[model samples]
Target: MHMHVALCAVLDPSEMPGGYRFEAIENLVLSRLDRLPPFTRRLVMDPLGLDHPHWIEDPEFDPIHHIRRVSCPAPGGSHELGRLVGRITSRPLPRDRPLWELWVVEGLAEGRFAIVAKVHHSAVDGMMGAGLMVNLFGMTREPAPEAPPPREEEHPVPPEPRPSDIEMLKSAARKRLAQPRKLVDLAKRTVERVGGVVERRRDPELAHGGTPLTAPRTRLNRPIGPQRDVGFARLSLAELKAIKAAVEGAKLNDVLLAVVGGALRRYLAHHDDLPEVPLVATCPIATGAGRGNNNVAAMFVPIATHLAEPEARLEAIQAATRGAKEEHAVLGKGELLQDWADLAPTTTFSVASSLYSRLKLSKHHRPVHNLIVSNVPGPPMPVYLAGAELEAAYPMGPILDGAALNVTVMSYRGQVDFGFMVARDVVPDVWRLADAVAPAFRELRDAVLGAPSEASPERSTPAE
Candidate 1:
C-alpha cells in the first residue's frame, strides 16, 4: 500500500557537482543524472512490483538500499527542474524499479544544490520523511570514522517489465474501442454515490464538520502550470512555544498557524491584495486512523490576520482552530457504519476539489484564502547517518488547484524548518514570502511571549 509520494526543492545549482561528490550517509544510493524533458514529455517511472518490494540493497544482505540522485544539466536550470518534477509526479509509479528517486540538481548562480525526492507515501510519511534525512545525514563535520555493516539485507532483483511503453499505448487504444464496462462501472458508481450523500444528511458525525466537501478558493489552490518556486525559512522551537504559552489555550500548532497567518497577510499586503476577511487554512485529517493507505480528510479553519494587531489575530485564530478541532472530534466518534454512510459521497477525491476550483467555490477562495499551511512535528533529538549528526530538515506537501502557495513546517531537533513553495508564475517572489515568515514569528513572540531580539538562523546542511 505504498502511495506514490513525490516532492521537489530548488537550490544553489552551483554547489551541486561538489555536493554530488560528498556521498550520502550510505554507499548503496544510486545517482540518476539525465537531461530534463519539457512539460509535455512524459517521464519514465520504473515499474515497482512484488518481487521488487520497492526496496534496494548492495551485494550484502543489508537494508537501506535507497537514495538515488537524478540530475538534469544546466541551461534548463530551475524552471526546467519544475517541468521535470511535474513530469515525474503527474504519472503513477511503474511497478518495477525502486519506488523512490532523489534528483540531485546542478547548474545555478550560487554554490547550492537542490534535491527532488519521490518515495511511495506508504513507505514514508511527513514524520518519517524528516527522520529519514536526519538518520541518513551526519551532524558532525569531522571526517567519517570506521563504520559497521548495514542494519538490513540486500534487496531481491526486480520483477520483469510489463508490456513495453509502446505496447501499453496500443493496448490502451484497444480498450478504448471495446470496453463498455468502464463506462458502466462509472455509471453504477455515480448512482450509488447519489444515494449515499442523501442518507448522510441524517448521520450525526457527517453532520458535524459543516460542508466538509466545500473548500474555499485560494491563490495557492490554483491550476498550477509546470513552473514552481521554492523558498526556505526557519524558527526556533523555544520562540514558537513561547508564543503558545502566552495564549490562554494556544497549542504549539496554533503558534504555527499564527505565524503562517502573518506571513501570508504580509505577502498579500505587499501586493495591496490582502483579503479583508480571514483566510481559511485547510489542514489534513487522518481518515484511516490506524488503518493506512491514502485515506485523509481535511479541516479548513479561518485564520484572522486582517486585523493589524498580531495578538488579536492569534487569539482570533486560536478560537477558530478550536472550533474546527471540535467538529473533527465529533466526526471521528461516529460509528463505523455511520462513517461509511456519511463518507461514501465524499470518498471520491475529485467531487469536492472540482467544486472548489470551478463552479460553486467558497467565499474564502473567491478572494483567495492567503495560502495553505501545515506543520508536521518531527523528532526533536538529533539522528545519525552511520553516525554523522543530522542537520536541518524540511517538509513539503502537494499543491492543489486554485492555491498557488503551500507553506509546510517540519520541526527537527530544536528548530522548525519552513518551506514556502509557490507556483512559479503565480508567486514569482517566493523568497520574499520566506523572509516574511521570520518577522511574523517574531511579531507573535513579542506580543504573546515578550521574547527578546535575535537573528533568524540559516538552514543547516550536512557538510562533506
Candidate 2:
C-alpha cells in the first residue's frame, strides 16, 4: 500500500515582472531535482512480491511527470486551495513510477501560489522530509550556485537488476527454516521490554496514564473512506513560546497538545458525541538523526479533553506526557517496532492488509487511539524557494483505518502552521475544527497571561 505524506506551502510571488510562469517554475524544480539525494529518486518493491523490497533508481525517470502546474477555480482563496489539495491527496501515487510528486499550483489571490509535495511514508519520515525541504529551498531569495557545469554527453545511470521470483522464493524458504532461532531471540527481547514497561507502570506517578486499547471512541475514530478533507490554521510561534515560558514545566509541544485537546472537545460537543473519558492522541516522535527516513516512535498522550478549564487541561496533559516520556525511556530507544516489522512475511502482510481494508475491520474493533497529532520542527531562519518567500507551510499526514483524523503542526521561521486532515465521510466539516485551533490557543494564553482588561481589543479577538 502507498502511504503518502504531503505538505503544502504558500509562497509569495517570485521576483518576476508578471509573477512566476509555469515554464520557469518547472525549470527551477528540474534543476533542483538533479541535485536531490539518490533515495528520493528510488521506489520500493519489485514486480513480484516474493522477497523483501529495497529502493532502486527509476530508469525511465522524468521530472515533468512528477512536477506539473495546476490552477484553482475562480475567487482563488484558501478554501479553493484546500479543496484542490483534498482532491490531489485522495488518489494514491502510481506504483509503476517513483513514489513522489510536486505540483506548482496557481490562480490564487494576492499574486501568491502554493506548492504541494507528496512523498510516500516508506521513503521519508518527518525529520527527513524537513531536511528535504531545506535542501530544495534556500536561505535567501538569490542563492549562490553550487552545482557543477553539466556535461554535453551525460548518460542516465541504469538501475540495478531485481532478483528473480525463483531466487526470492528459495531465500524465503531458507528464512522460514531459520525462524525457530529468530523466534527465540525475539521472545527474549519481547519479555525484557514488557517487563521494563510493566515495572515503569507500577510507579504511582505513571499508573494513571492511558495505555494501548484504552482510548475512548469518538466520531473521529471510525472506518475512513478514500475521500479526504484538508483544512489549515496559523498560530504565532512567539506567543506560543511566551505562553510556554509563563507556565511551569510547560513545553511548546505540551501547549500544542492542550490546544488540540480543547478544540477536539468543542468539536465533539458540537456534534453531541463527546466521550466521558479524555481523548488520547498517538504522538509520533522522530528518532532519526540527519538525513534518515522512517525513523520514528510513538507514545499515547492523554489530551485531558474531559477537563473543562484550560489551565486544568494543560496541567493534566503535562503530567500525562511526562509519564508517557518516562515509559518510552524505560522501553529504550531501540527501533523495536521496526525490528518486529522485519519478521512479517511480505506475501502474508499484503494479503492481510487487503482483507482488513476490504472487510472494514476498523469499524468493528475498538480504536487504538482517537487520532494522530504530530509536531515537526522546521528551520527558524527564513526559507525561500525559486526566489519566492515561503509564507507558511502546513503538513498533512495520512489517515489510517481507525484513526480518521490527523493534525500536524510545522513551526516555520516565526509562525506555526497547522494542517488538519480528516476523512470526508466522517467529518466533512473539518474547517470548523481548524478554525477552533486559534481560539483554543487563546484560551490557554489567557489562562497563562492573566485575563486582558475589558478596554483592550486583543482580549476579545483571537490571534490569527
Best by lDDT: 2
What tens-digit string does per-residue lDDT give for candidate 1 at 234-325? 67887777667767888887788888889888987888777676777777645545432234556667777677789998877777676666
lDDT, each prediction: 0.53, 0.77
Cand. 2 Cα-lDDT: 0.77
TM-score of 2: 0.91
Best by TM-score: 2
- Hey, what RMSD does candidate 2 come out at? 3.6
Per-residue error (Å), model 1, residue 121: 4.0
Q: What is the C-alpha lDDT profile of model 2 across 236-331, one tens digit per residue? A: 778788778989999899999999998998899999998989998989886553323578888889999998899999999989888888777666
